[model samples]
Target: GGLPYVLTAHEGSAAFAADVMGRLTGAPGLCIATLGPGATNLTTGVGNAYLDRSPLLALTCNLPTAQLGRRIQMAIDHHALFRPLTKATLALREGAVASVLAEALQVALSEPLGPVHLDLPEDVALAPATEAVPAPPSGRRLAAAPEPARRRAAELLGAARRPVAVLGSSAMRLRNPGLLQAVIERHRLPFATTTMAKGMISEEHPLSLGCIERARRQVQRELLGGADLVVGLGYDVVEVEYEAWLGKVPLLSIDVDPVDADASVTIAHEVVGDLDASLGWLAQLPPARPEWGADLAARHRERFQRALRPPRAGFVPHHAIDVVRAALPRDGILAFDVGAHTHQIASQWTAHAPRTFLITNGWSSMGFGLPAAIAAKLACPERPVVAIVGDGCFQMTVGEVAVARRLGLSLPIVVLDDGWLSLIQVKQVRRRFGLYGTDLGEQALVDPPAHYFGVPAIGAGSAAELARALTDALVADHPTVIEARVDPGHYLDTVYD
Candidate 1:
């Protein structure tokens, strides 16, 4: 296979890297692992692909055919271990390598793309065989739903007093966003994006309601509360259920597949087929002059902007994010780790392009930032890539710094240092519980190693210092870790829903 690969620090790291590669490249990303412990570590990222609908192929080594059932070292029921975590669990039989591989790829990249596990027994690891013809990838350019269904969908939009649209994770697969944006503009619809779908359209676009899961989520949710029609364009219910947001509102779905609307969400009409074709159909429908005053999305967008303004002057998360945003170019890739910082960036960061902002809203794993950034850099070397991790997240994946250094990857690892699991701490406090296990002991990166396994480690105490550090890392030969010592006070002040 001509596919690119990296020797990651851990099996989990490799899988996460594959996950990002799949999302960014719109093809199956492949990761190889050894038996037992290696197979076990891959579950987190593999599960992320399962729920997130990313195309991934997880190849693992196992005991030889005769010894597979015995209690040999590093032997376990791998098929059982991965069955629940993958779309399909397959094995390499004597002469079926080619066919098994073809099936695995077909399943991994099918509708609602997900991870597929392929186990290669030791004896068959180096075997050569005739290659089987792989199934052709599914065509996404199908005609929009039947004319009656589309007309009904259009009729619902035409008759509704207030209709809103939501862009979901599936939108990332869009080959032409211009068509999607045309439909949004033609209808003058207000729109909100799921966390993972951030930047399908520019967050700064006048029609954007920003992301709906964090930072003033109440404001965004309330905007969706009064909708008469909710247009779910390529929206996948895994990131958010229709019941939580849309409630009993009538839904019109336009995507490559039928929308997974919850029971409470009435299917007013569904235009299921090619998204661009549906969007083209919507664009051609005589523009409907609805009852919404002005564009509700653009109007609410102002309120969202007001709420996200720099709330305090200290070296806080919001301010730190502002600095990073300013230093990063419009095309730079930001891979965010899961934590309190995720809540802030998901809403506050201004994303102009799809796949430029990578976060795991489906599985939402910690320690995802480093590997994701590394893989993103590998995929698109011309674009600058940075990993924004929390203090806790940095500790969990710190060993990957060695991987970054070894590869001479020009990636920057930015750690927001508050020394605790801030997101979980908020929940504990809400329950009137003490800090307990959330604390990470030390708050400062005192006497931080000058070089982490040959990669430089630097400290930034203020916004100005952080900007300088990021600027330098962009041109560095290897990975640079910048510990931005920031206060966590702003997290409690701003993040919500």
Candidate 2:
């Protein structure tokens, strides 16, 4: 109970920290705040995690029951507001802490995980219940599944001539990379991941197919749609584009939660349970043909190699990603917030393991990368955490740079400074919007940004300077901010709508 507590400068960072911890550990992440303004400020982060289906716990203090709904601005409907984004929401009643906590934990950890809010009044939190809090059943234990469904999944995985497996965020949390690897090797199947599911298996693995978000359009065209059968293992198509296209492929969906099911479902068979166990059973059936595996594997490697063009010389988007990737340890973690830059980096930066890459795929929220890196470092202090943030987004949460320094985390942040909001600027160029609110002048640039959080931040105009800044951060004991100035034109591939 005596855990060390950190004072975060902002509630959003706290919520993000909880979300990352939850995603990384496969356990519920936790966040707590005082009454009134604290609760309201934390809502944005709560909503972000909820929309992304991240398992999180947000705890907030409320006024006494006597004050319920009485001219209280902060007394907004917490339960109702969260219902759309969460599996369960609760306002702690008198003497209900233990029972409520147990139930909340259960709901929070269950399949189709999402942010769970708990409103505890000050009086209720202090008031002790006479009875012991009932211990919840081990959250990881699987519920029984019908035999027919299991057989169907097995049959689908077994009969296919050219089959592939798509892993999602939930599969990564379940931490069965070995099991996944076993199935892939036994059946000789190519494995692909959604953006959030990066690093679930080692990228170095021959069968590792790479991320769908980054896969070349050609690969998406030829390989993904070409499969005779596709297994969506904890895959949530809602987060990925090309769902309508995926509908055409024969889908065998395996999700533990009913909410994971889609109304426009193309699944011929659905198997929900402890995925590791279900998959383990499926692996026991006759192994998939080696020839089928060899064909897909060769095509996957060929496409990945084709997608990669040596980062263009000079100041290019791919070059920037290459610089960062070169400086990073082969297994170092990376997080990218939504921006025009993300499309390029996601396609370029190679992830080697699960939870190594973090992003808000479903919410596509701006100003999330810095906070995600902060959160990732907090959870795994041993790893090198990098945030590839945009010029526009860097301004939004740049204050957190000071927070990182204060936390004494040696986080290295690379800011891609292009004067305009590149993504929006592209949209404006495409004439999607008559008015371009995306334009910003020198005023938008953090003038004298050289010194970030009192640490001497360096500005890089070319690849050489970029390399020097990265070297300093890798060697320094303190946090370093490397501001790389990139031409907006260099990112035209992404900026052009």
Candidate 3:
């Protein structure tokens, strides 16, 4: 494989990087860790992969077989630790290393791909006479939806007065993702996207209804409620469950994974199989004259845009995000950490293609943004990549900035310094609770450092300064940290409620 083994500052960071690799490359990403603490640190990222459906191969060392299960120093049960967090957990025996790894790869890469753990005993790592691992598995054509279900789904769509296709992240994993656009546009149906699915089709497309799950959510929900039919294109409930949006409306789910049978949502038809091929089947559907047309989508898109604007702002985090979005290209990759800022980025940022807009939603974790951006840069070095993280989240993986500097990556890590765990503080304010520990010692009032480790650091106190910094950082020869001072108080009005 031509994959690069980039060392991250922490095992947790490495795990995030591995998940990003798997999401981008569609192969099982590999991550190795020492025993005990290292493997434990990997759990959060691996769990993120498991729930978010990214393929990963997590490898960890354990005590030698002779002393296995004994109370050994620095040795904890690797399998038990990873068992709940991964798709499968295995211990690689001496002679079966290749076979075990081959199996692990398959399990990790299986449909609804997820993380798998493999343990290599101390003795096994030093063994000889081992055969080389074989070439990786090639892609296979997943089965298309059964004729009956596809026809049934098509019939439902044909009869509906209001039909909406919701593109989810899983759809991007399919072959010929263009088929998703083809099917929806062929029928002149209006569509909205889940956060992860935003850029599968250009958001600029006239039929686009913007994203659900963030910013002016009521409008998106209203649009969804008006639909007599809801078609899930490669949608996964883990992103946003059906009961939350679908209501009692008839659903036509077409994806690689089957719809959950126990879900409370009504299934007019559930078509499971190759989502790409199913789109071809859907192309044959008798087109419906949608009562809800471009007018509705335009209205919703505008409202989304209006709500997306940072409100009553004297340099809020939302304004900083707007500057970054304006400066970044339509095709640029943005990896963001979880916090109050994520609420704004999920809907405001323009994602031109899948995987171009990367964020952890299902297992939304802090410290993910920097590592994910690092992995994206490694995967597509020619592309412009940036990470926008909040002050609190950035502190979790600040050391990883040094790793980017060492790689000499021309990356920009934009940190929004808001002083508090603004997302949480907002919640406390609603209950009239005192904002005691939420403050990070008045970060915005403090002077910004000139560098993080060896990486060049700059300060941006205004929109113009932030834009200039981004323009400079994007083309720089090394990683740059642009810390922008801002008040995240606007989130108290927007996503806080």
Candidate with top lDDT is 3
Better of 1 and 2 by lDDT: 1
Point out the worst 10-residue segment of candidate 1 by lDDT.
135-144
Please report the TM-score between candidate 1 and the true structure.
0.94
- How does model 3 score by TM-score? 0.96
Which parts of model 2 are misplaced by more than 4 Å? 125-137, 257-266, 290-299, 305-313, 428-435, 442-448, 488-497
**Best-first order by TM-score:** 3, 1, 2
Query: Which candidate should be chosen as best, given TM-score against the real structure?
Result: 3
Preferred candidate (TM-score higher): 1 or 3: 3
Query: Candidate 3 lDDT, tens digit per residue, 397-482?
Result: 99999999999999999999988888788778988998877889865365577788989889888899999999999999999999
- lDDT (CA) per prediction: 0.84, 0.73, 0.85
- Give the per-residue lDDT of model 1 (tens digit) for 22-87: 988878888889999999998888998888888999999998888988998989999999999999
- Return the clash pairs for model 2, or none: 199-353, 199-354, 200-354
